[model samples]
Target: MNDSEDGRVQQLCSHDEEHLITSGTRYSIKGFRFEPPYVLKRAAGHLCRGHVPVVLQLFFLTLSAVLLLAVLIKGQAGMADGETPFLVTVSSIANTQGQEQAKKEKVYKEMSQLKPQINHLCRPCRWDWTLFQGNCYYFSKFQQNWHDSVTACREVGAQLVVIKSDEEQSFLQQMSKEKGYAWMGLSDLKHENMWHWLDGSHLLFSFMKYWNKGEPNNAGEEDCAEFRDDGWNDAPCAVEKYWICKKSAMSCTKN
Candidate 1:
């Protein structure tokens, strides 16, 4: 070959080697060159594009989960701050109503207790005198002999307690128990072994059961009857003791 032609051929071969190295081309044993096909590159690009939707879907799903959790927390907080107070208010109202009902019941009970005293008579009882049934009773603070006790009651336009029925006897007995021992109007001074009331009525045989056991044997000339908690007792007329006086409660006339 000529020198100029050989130099041109070497330059062309050098340029081709440089291109193969830069483009990552391979050579086979038979001196044939291989290069990646354009289709394989296009397939890689398509694979990368297909993964984009999956990444976006994962991000959006995570965001939705966080938002849902935040909404649930906010709803729970609202219930605690708002609904709790509403429940407490309802409980307080129920408690207030219960207390008011209790107070009303107590007031009604007190009024019922006062009704009997108000409806007994038109006129009120005197000071220090308690009215029960249709009669007024006076419990004496001072002690005196049986006869003197009777006189004291008579001076006040009353009489020593004359128990006519079991009810009256029970009332006098209860009062006498509270006021200490007291004198009644029964006596056998006129006739031994025979009892009579201050109102000139003879004591009924049934009333004798009111006497204490083994009493009224005229022991040491005991002639007067005294009231006690358990029953009646016979004592000397001169014995000093508290007394009870009785009188009819005055009724006012309506014009």
Candidate 2:
């Protein structure tokens, strides 16, 4: 070409190259080209400034939700595997304690019911009888003569109380004092000045001390022994008075 035209064409080409370099890359005859590193850096900065925070927030939120879900699932799994036996153990312990308490209460109730019966069996005495010193005694409410008193006692499978010890004598004497004079089983009817019990026991000299002061003088046909508050006294056999009867307590044995 001519020199001037070539120079114009070169100028145009240089202007186009400058425009392409100043602006972002564009499609050219040479094919596509990338932007400047600074331009790409600015765009990447814009993307980070606009969307990275949101993306990070979403990611953190998702991670938190997943962690919470995992914790819930683990808790549920633990409950499924272990809750039943734990509850059953607590319930079984409570039931066993309740049963034991019920059994104890039942036993206590049964013992309370049987206590009176056990006492009655041990004493082996009638409802109206008084038990003392392995024997049972009955104080008659009605008055009877010596002979009739014996009959009354025999009818109840008992006999007139025979005082054998000082303790028994004192007990009977106190009882007679409170209940008025009562007939005993001793008499001097068989021989003068010699007392004998109805049970065929001879009165020993030690028993003579039981006689009241200046008593047993056999005054005015007095032959039967009557118990007084202070001591024994001889009285008329026919005279009516309250009487005492006694018997051995029944023995109990276990089978």
Clashes of 2: 0
> How many angstroms is residue 226 displaced in model 2 relative to the true structure, after the best TM-score fit?
0.5
Clashing pairs in 1: none
Q: Which candidate is the best by TM-score?
A: 2
* lDDT against the true structure, each candidate: 0.77, 0.77
131-237: candidate 1 lDDT, tens digit per residue: 98899999998899998999999999999988889998888888888889999999999999889999999999989899888887788999999986699999999
Can you tell me which runs of candidate 1 are displaced by over 4 Å? 1-122
How does candidate 2 fare on TM-score? Answer: 0.53
lDDT of model 2 at residue 123? Answer: 44
